[model samples]
Target: MPRILAVDVYQVAMPLKYPWRTAYGEDHTIETILLRLETSEGIGWGESSPLPQPHYVEQWSAAAFLCLQQCLVPAVLGRSFGSPEELQQAMAFVKGNTFAKAALDLAWWDAAARAQQKPLYQLLGGTREQVPVGADFGVMDHPEELLPLVEEAVAQGFPRVKLKFRPGWDLPVVQAVRQRFPELVLHIDCNAGYTLRDAELFEQLDRFRLAMFEQPLGYDDLWEHAQLQRRVQTPVCLDESVRSLHLARQALALGSCRWINIKPGRVGGLTVAREVLQLAAEHGVPCWVGGMLESALGARHCVALGTLPGMDYPADIFPSDRFYEEDLGDPPLVLDRDTSGRPVACPLEAPGTGTEPRPDLLRRWTVNHFHAHA
Candidate 1:
């Protein structure tokens, strides 16, 4: 049996070039917990980067940080394990701290792949070497400001574009995008910012033939979401509503969502993420991985996850260079188009995540860091 060697946790904060706004809040910096799991064979890395506050979910960077240090880290230190799944099974008792547990789970998976000297994607059963990618355009102050970005993403060959929507910004914003790029693959992320009365808003949106209307109503309101689904021409894609395998099943059984956006950190880790993919596939629901504006290290995890077979839609990944000015390190997330002009992310060939954190950057941005002995 392979005994875990060490776990190192680092708190990293990097400034974004521009503030990205959504229905939840505005963010100007990316803060995350990067975990490095070591074995005698090698090192494996994973990231748990939630937003600074709990706008997206109840878990924030600060809370997740402590959860890993005080609760999650202590649970598995120095423990022996055959595979990442085994470690994940041991972690169920920790409860609700999905992003916190995700840091450890992802590192273990990366560690397992490192031990075998195989790509994380291959170990996770990914078929495509090049992953189809998509980019999200956050809510802007003006429709004029939003158009250029959309045009640029389209010109850069991103096959799908996700736009953020709130109450006032819903109908007109999407209408304007449709007028400009009539054929752009599009969807709107409601971020659980709307109410039942807003069903009429979606009715107007139905004419645009959006790929889906994502999380249009309140979070955890599955029945209402199912109600909205039947009333609209657009498929309802759940983001905040579906967290675990059980919630996903209920969502499916209730016809709550036609699609799902699975964020590894949001769920726990790739182990549960894979389970979500399997569940989505069995029920014929389309799914995509959502990014939290991760630095290079975290984006690499997304690249690894994108390789799975059930990632049937364009993953929400971005060109690292364009997404972040500085990162832990670079991975081969270059943007290009496939035969049908769908954006593709080139998979890393080296074992594990294939990208290591740059030491200088880590030292400069690390607010705090600690080590755990196995």
Candidate 2:
């Protein structure tokens, strides 16, 4: 078994190509924490973007850093774990802070994979080499500003598209997209912007025949989502609500959602994500991978998780160039198209994720850094 030798945490701010506006807020630059874990055998990298604020979830960038440096790192710094679950158990004493835990969890998984000389997906029991990915468009000032991006995504051979939905950018924006590309596979992510009071609005949206409506209610409310699901024909997909496997089971039992969006960082890294996917599979509910605008390092884990069975929906994974002009991680992620011409993302055959922060880029973007040794 490989024992953790040292850990490095970097607080980096990677500039986005444009401001990504969602229901929670707008992000001009994605401020995230990246972890580099060195083991007896090799080194591995991980990332968790809590953004600059806690509006997306309870965790934020600065808090996640402190949690890792003061809590998570100390829990398993000198420990040797045979499995990712063991590493997770070591940090079980800490409550919440899934993003902070994920930084360590992801690095352990990556390091373990590299130690065994296997692709991360293969180690995770993935059934496929590549999976289809979807393009996402954030909220724009006008439908006109959004249409061109949708058109570009379509022309680029993406199989599906996700549009950010909020109060002012709701009906009219969706109506415009539907008019332009009626047959395009479309879904809307509300980022927990609406409540059950907007059930009528969701009911009205059924006329558009979306693939699903994602996180329209409160981020932590399951009962309201269940009630909202009962009144709407479009399938409700839970994002922020499904934070853990326990929450996933509750959502399924209460009929809170028909689809689940699994993000590694949101679910405490790939260990819990795999458990949720398996749970969703057993229940016959489909699942899809979602992203947090991470650089190539984190996006690689999303791609690997997407390869598992029952991830039927196109993922929110995108190429590095989609958001960043120059990627922060080495070996920039480029989409691989299948024979059908649909854009897809594939896990690297090389050991681990085959990505890490470029030394120069890391030095340029890092606002804070912490290091600890066994």
Candidate 3:
């Protein structure tokens, strides 16, 4: 068991190379909460990126920071946790701040892996050396502009590509991509932008042959998604809706989705992430890891999780340079190309996530920081 002795929490805004426009809104910078846990055995790092605002999910960066500073940290600062699940249990009293709890859970897992002298993937029981990663594009100024980017991703040997789908940028854009790259594995993320009434429109999309429609309904919805899934021939993939193991089970039982996009922070952390992956696998549902534009520190955990069995689809993981001009984390992630030329990512042999925040960048980008001692 490792007893936590101190904690340092930082709220940072890492500038993006390009504005990431989604259905909800556009973000020029990714605001995230980072945790450095000092345990009896060693140090660990964790990150949870809620957008600057509450549009994507109810938890935003500032609120997640308060939840950790005022409640979550006080509950577990001096406690010894035998496992990440135990750490999660300690924070159970505070509900619905999965993003806040995730920072702690992820830190604990990183610490445990380091203490055990193993990489995070091995600790999570993943044996795969590398996993294919897909490229994702946000809403561009024009659909025609998307063609060149998609072409670049294809030229780089990416296996799949994801486009951000919104009302103004919907059918015509998808049509253009499908027409241009007829054989590319394609998908569109609605980001909870549609309702069940749009069934006719989604039905219109079946011809494009998308890999799936990700989170087409409300962020907290399940039944409506089931309705939409039943109406559309294309596979439905749930993202914002499946927040925990319980929600995952509900979605599966209702046939709400054929695929699940597992973003560790969205579902809490790696502890629940693993449970959700297992549950999805048992139900024969394909799963893939999604990114939140986190730095290499946070993305590294996602890359490690992608190697686990049942992660059938290509992940949303990207190299450091894809989003940031200069990575905020040390030893920025670089993609590897497989024999067939598909872009892939592998967990570093170093223990834990194999990356940490660069102290200078951490100091420069931090809007606020909280420190505590046990």
Candidate 4:
């Protein structure tokens, strides 16, 4: 068995190329907690970056950084684990810090994949070398600026484009996009901003033939969502609502949603994600992976997990440069369009994630760093 030899934590703040405005908040910088676990075999990296604040989940960077240093790191530092599952069992003592746990779990998988000399995707039961991807832009106040983005995405051959919408900004944006690119694969994400009364609006908007309506109501209210699902033609995709395998089971049984958007951070770790994936497959509910606008590390993990058979469509796996001006990965993920004009992301064939972090870039952006020796 390969014993854990060291753990390093880095808290980083990287600026986005353009300001990001969402229902969550308006921000220009992306804050994250990056984790690296070193074993006798090699180095593995992961990210525990929360979505701005506790609004997405209770996990935040400051608390996650603290949890990692005080509890999570100590529990798994000296343990001998050959695989991520074993490492997950070793760290089972601490509970509910899924984002914190997932960052480490991801790193362990990367390290384990390296030890086995296989790509992380292969270890995760992935099938394709290249996965089709889509882009999800943030909320725009102007709404006029929305059409061009949709037009650009269509020209670039993207299969799907998700735009964020609030109550006041909803109708026109949907109307404009539909009119401009009638054949485009479009969807709307409200980020849980409406009520049961909004069903009428969805009924009217359904004429445009959107791919889905994402999280239109409250985050945890599955019962109400089931009611809303019956009212609209567009499928309801639960993002913040479905957090675990059990929650997924409940959502399915309740008919709460026709589709689900799975983010590993929201669910805790890949173990639960895999379970949910299997569950989604069992229920015939089409699932897509949601992005937290992760840097290369988190994105790679998302890409790897998205490769599973149940991941039916294009994911929100945009190009790295879409957010960061310069990412830490040496050859940052650059997406290419397939023959059908959809973006294609080939899985890393080299050991681990197959993307190496640039030493200088890591040192430049890192605001805080700590190391623990086993």
Candidate 5:
């Protein structure tokens, strides 16, 4: 039996020079909750909580982390890595606290993969070696800011760019970027900024030839999205609202959206994420993995899941170097660049999620700390 050695939570802040605006919300900094799980044999890492943004899942908070430290960790200690299903069931008692449960569930998977000396993706039965990636750019103050940003991202080798869209800014921003980079793959994420009244505006968006329009209506309003899907030519993709496999099924059954964005933390963990992906595949609804500015630990998990067979769309899994000043992993997650200047692969060569924390970087960015049992 493997005894749990420790569980530590750290809060880190990454400041963005300019405000990152999106239809769902805006922010000047990214607040991250980093979780480290250690056993007598090895260590595993995970991240829960969004970047203190309103639109993303708000289920995680500092108080929730405290709850994890006090209650969840103790329950998980001394557990064996019998199987993913067994570990998942063992943690099922911590229901109604998905974020906290996600942190623990992800860590357990990481540890199990390490114990077997296998990559996380291998454990998940995915092996395409690579998945297409796209950049999710922040909304700029001026539409003029987009050309240069698009050019810069293109120059840096991003295959596609998804711009943040708000009401007044949506058409102009897409048109400007399209005019400059007519051949580039361009998509839009409304973050649920539009209402039924704005459904006609999507016709205007059709002129720009967007790849997709994401979450144009309220997060929870699957019925509204289904109506919008009927009215619009551009395929609709749901983000925040599809929290569980059941919600995903509801959205698919109603024809709410043609695409779904799977963020593991929001869905509970990779366990639920897999279920969502399986559901999407069964229904023939396309899906892609979404990002939340995660550290290497969390990003690796996304990469592992994104490598599945039906994940045909470009994922938002950019390399850790793009956001982190210093990474948790020694070899840091590398984006395998191709001669065409696009990232072709994200390798998971190391065991587990293939990430280990840098103590020095952890010390500099972590502002708060807490410990839980086991």
Candidate 6:
């Protein structure tokens, strides 16, 4: 039996090239808490990168890390990873701290896959070697400003492009991007920008033949989204509203959303994420993996989940080169391109997530930390 020896948490801040804005808030930097779990014999890592604003979901704070260090880790110190199901069940006793719970869950999955010498995706029932990748661009001041960004992303070979939408900027942005890149796959993410009263705007947006209209109303407004869906021709995709498999089912049952953006941290873990996928499949709605501007640790997990059979839609997992100045692994998560210049999936042949953290980069960005049970 393997005994948990130590748990370490580090706060690392990475700068973004441009400020990222959404209906929730805006940020020029990404601050994340990385979880390091060590057994008597080996180590596994995970990330808890909460969005900067509490609008979508609550932001991850240093206090959260303190809670994990003092409360969560102690409870699991001597626990055994006998089975994923059993491990997850043991975690149920420590509920309400979803972000902290997600870090532990992700580390447990990583440890389990490492113990089995398999990739995380295979452990989660992924069938494909690679999946299509897309880029979710942020909102700009003007629609014309997006043309160059779209052109650059196209040159880098993204199969699909998703634009951020706010009330005043929604229509013109979509129309301009659609007109310029007529054949490019286009999607819009409102980030819960509209309300039931904005039905007229949603009607106008239907003319663009969007790939999907994401989170058009309040994050928790399932009935409102269902109402919006009824009024608009564009298919609806839910992001912020999906906090768990139960919420996902509710949204699906209410006919509020046709697709879901599965973010492992946001939903809980890959274990629960798989449950959401199974639920989506049973209900006949397709799902896609969404990115949270993750470092390689989180990104690798996203790529792994995207390889699931029913997740045949284009993913937001672009190549590591697009976001990171320095990545967290060897043979960094590379984005492969097809003959037609669209981003294709590259399977991980190595064990687990197939990458290791770059200690040098960690040293440069990590601000404060102390080892517990070291």
When summed lDDT is taken over every stretch of 10 residues in candidate 3, the lowest stretch is: 77-86
Ranking by lDDT: 3, 2, 1, 4, 6, 5
TM-score of 2: 0.98
Best by TM-score: 3
Model 6 lDDT tens row, 1-374: 55678888777776666688877678776776678878765777777666554666654646557667777777787777665556557667765455666777777777767877888788877888778988777877776677998999888878789988886667878888888888888899988878999899889888889989988898767999998889888999998788778898899899998989998877777878888999999999999988777777778878888988778579877566676677654557777777787777666876677766688877887766757783
Q: What lDDT does the true structure give each of the candidates?
A: 0.83, 0.92, 0.93, 0.82, 0.77, 0.78
- Regions more than 4 Å wrong, model 1: 339-342
Each candidate's TM vs. the true structure?
0.96, 0.98, 0.99, 0.95, 0.91, 0.92
For every model shown, the clashing-pair count is: 1, 0, 0, 1, 0, 0
Top lDDT: which candidate number?
3
By lDDT, the better pick of 5 and 6 is 6
Expressed as tens digits, the lDDT of each residue in 205-245 for candidate 2 is: 99999999999999999999999999999999999999888
Candidate 5 C-alpha lDDT tens digits along 46-96: 776566644555554565576577667777776665555665677667655
Looking at candidate 2, the ten consecutive residues that score lowest on lDDT are: 107-116
Q: List the residue pairs that clash in candidate 2.
A: none
Which residue pairs clash within candidate 3?
none
Clashing residue pairs for model 5? none
Candidate 3 per-residue lDDT, tens place, 11-115, comes to 999999989899999999999999999999999999999889999988899999999999999999899988888889999999889999999988888988998
Residue 97 displacement in candidate 1 (angstroms): 0.7
Ranking by TM-score: 3, 2, 1, 4, 6, 5
